[model samples]
Target: MLKGKLKLPDRLGNLVVDFEDRDDKIGGSSSVLASSEELEIILPNGLGFSRHKDDGDGLCCTEEKKTNEAAIFRASARPYKDRAGSVSAMAFIAADEKRSDFEYQSELKKNTEEELSSSKQNVDGDSDGLLRRHEISSEDHPLSLGKASVWNQYFQHMDIIEQIDRDLKRTHPEMEFFSGDTSFSRKNREAMKNILLLFAKLNPAIRYVQGMHEVLAPIYYVFCTDIDEKNVANAEADSFSCFVKLLSDSVDHFCQQLDNSSGGILSTLSRMSELLKANDEELWRHLELTSRVKAQYYAFRWITLFLTQEFNLQSVLRIWDSLLSNPFGIQEMLLRVCCAMLLCMRSKLLSGDFAANLKLLQNYPDVNIEQLLHVANDLSPDVSSYCPPL
Candidate 1:
């Protein structure tokens, strides 16, 4: 159901999950094992490294440069919204920009949250402990003497809310030839609603944070848009499974306790800094020392939210195409994209003061999406075409 190939760690050995970590079944054969390579991301074309004429600097991401100068895009700031999820980016690519799946998922999530929130009047402190109450006290409501059965109440309301939602979504069936008010629509809504509700229920530690809709939206969109009729029909279940997998990889960024651990957000930020340093030390130093810009100041959202906020939805999807297929895994690919973002704005960043640079970085500028992604693709750690960012 996934439109893009699942980005897997290289050690996964052509497998999305680690192949070597297989359980010791009495015996298992290679033929019987499923192959995930079909889903392995392949660059659509022209994004590949091109051989350029020789200049003194050998083998790099150069494009017909007479002096073999490092490639760089002239960055310019026009406008941007903080993009929040790679999953959302991927969701946009399954079809045209206008009718992306991410939109559908987020809309559904919003509708669900509002429905659930408005139903219970006592959503005051907004704590998991508070929400765990199956029944609110009569004194809290002051009007109803009967107790509330949260489960029964939610289900009863879920049907009504979902029906309303299906009616709304059904109005626009022209998009991707999607059916309106059909069994599939009801089923899809129920599945997506359950996934969102269940995720909130299971992860009581963090509860349901905002922007999760960004993550779940695209998965459902991508699945429902799948060319296969059967896959389109099962979009909800497929989306639920993919959302779990995608969220699992990123949930640590949301957990407060794990903030300083080796696997936490801080560690990821450090790695991103190191990635930038390896690719362009001067830029790294200027941002870190000259500008004294903290990684967390700008990179926290970039890393955690996955650049959904950094660029237009279309641009993010273009980058995510490579990210989801990077073979090295999403984390590594993401850092490269972030670094490319910096390099794209090299001149401004180099000349700007701390405040200016910070402001610019925080509100990343728009650039040629193709060039930006190409620069990022050239920044791979293991295989460098010496395509140093100018």
Candidate 2:
């Protein structure tokens, strides 16, 4: 008989497997590990094992005769990484044809739930650790139920709520999910509202703002339309997690107190001006002198709202794809995009005066998004140098 315990790393979370060998068969159960949605097992000597969902049962071997010969077993909670770099353990096993079928199903379900709980922990905590102290409550706001509370937390933030509601009613009017008061629309609105409320509650410093809905719309839409149907139901929860991740990087722009901080929008605008000067000094000089346009006049909206208000929905989404995908962070990509937008309308911008240039920038003209992104990417290779330190 053999008995031992296995330990996984911090990245893998706490996963322990305890095994015992008896009567030529080995049995063990794995403690829940992070991201354990699916478990993969490899039997020694190329013996195959298949699980049947129709009838809950113990794993079945491809060849009945080889079952008795199976002496070594390896199970992984996730895709196996390189063993050389990964921490691992070895255990020997013998397959038993008479193992309890119900026990296997019960264990599988328990493992799944543990993995889910672990995954939620990762999403909630995030990389910056801002979310660690905040606890999300399932209790519906009093406004949702129309029931008054002692503190009136919901009522205290009614203005923000009303703004969010009004924006939800007006946003993406053409899209079915955002258009009517239908079930889908309500679900999306509720998701957005809940996220904003929780965010404000968690970080009172940045609270809810008017244009935040626009910033959150695309993220919710993308998550809700996930290709995996299993994930669709949890779209709202997942979107909340992702929204927090996005905001963690750019939250300074939304906080007025941080205006002069290195991470703030004012600093971002200064960096944008530097980038423009480097990329197109003549165009930069023209905008500053002839148009009397300063970075803050237009960049306040562009930087804070992430250009969401400037471009059409389709174009905004495309630009966001580039912005989010950039390894250098959103601010650097944003400045480049701002520069590209200016350069794209160089002729019109240079020819226009103060009012005309301001109008053109505030009401950005519709341009080929692909071309715009291409131009943004084509800016100086050392764009990072111009970006303010985070």
Candidate 3:
């Protein structure tokens, strides 16, 4: 396993690897390490991996030649002096601290009534995160989900998006871009209404949810290539129908959340809660004991709307640029944001515990978004003695 990992690059993410090893000097003498290599990743079924050559374009300049489902990575075995363990270790430590900070912020929610009352406005503001003020409606921001004409218009946007997606993959091998056929161009409000009806027919479990439109906002931006692009002529009918099918499939993540045990919006927020508890037992206990568990409700909308409903639309766009471009890191980024928000209300949160803590947390959003961003970006590791293997 060491030899195999040594053959790859010094950084990896979202991949799993298997290896058989018995090394007393390393983690243990276990015959098999389910995950032993820190910098190695196993490719998922659809991913295509390639190596960079000194004279080559590094897989970004051209489309992948091999479409195979499985492959191993290798590179020149350079001297150990070239290792970037410090930098990689920093990322791992940052991730761990992020987990701890999330717990700390949650615990801080417990405080006295006086502090909670004064901090109430902040909590409401933070509950929404930074929301975009721009509103999309049938008249101005019309999206025709299922109509033939709307589908055609939507295709024009998809073409632009698909081209960009392919280009990005070639240019940035580390990033992933998703594009599926979905239409947004509607000829009329009636067509748009029919599209929604169709969406319901396809998935009866998901009646329309308010924030879903915002969830699909990226597709609109990507498809149209610009927010300024107005409605265009609808395309061929056959192409439009195919595109609608894809659109339905593409938006499933948001849709799935709608049907989640908790409302769809809350489910993603809960995903963070579940992950934190599974990964950090001590911090979880601290939060429960402190009576700060209600922070989850305050943090819910930030995840559901992708922070679209909380701040200026322009700033929200920048946040989305980070969130969509790096889905893997966004969850951690969110936890950091939660911590930063709590820090802004530290006076209130620190005043007391238990019932007081819940009251304090109720008024969370009073902190400034800019301050939250700074804390999130500069967050340090939580310094726990029981640091687990990454």
List of clashing residue pairs for candidate 2: none
Kindly provide the TM-score of model 1 when superposed on the true structure, using C-alpha atoms.
0.50
Q: By TM-score, who's the top model here? A: 2
lDDT top scorer: 2
Off by over 4 Å in 2: 1-154, 381-390
Question: On a 0 to 100 scale, what is the lDDT of residue 45 in model 1?
Answer: 40
Off by over 4 Å in 3: 1-198, 214-271, 274-287, 327-340, 352-371, 378-390
Write down the lDDT of every candidate, Cα atoms only.
Answer: 0.63, 0.72, 0.45
Which is the winner by lDDT between candidate 1 and candidate 2?
Answer: 2
lDDT of 1 at 202: 71
Better of 1 and 3 by TM-score: 1
Candidate 1 residue lDDT tens string, 283-318: 989999988998999998887767866775556667
Ranking by TM-score: 2, 1, 3
| Candidate 3 Cα deviation (angstroms), residue 112 | 94
The model with the greater lDDT, 1 or 3, is 1
Q: What is the lDDT of residue 171 in candidate 1?
A: 28
Question: Lowest summed lDDT over 10 consecutive residues: which window, candidate 2?
Answer: 15-24
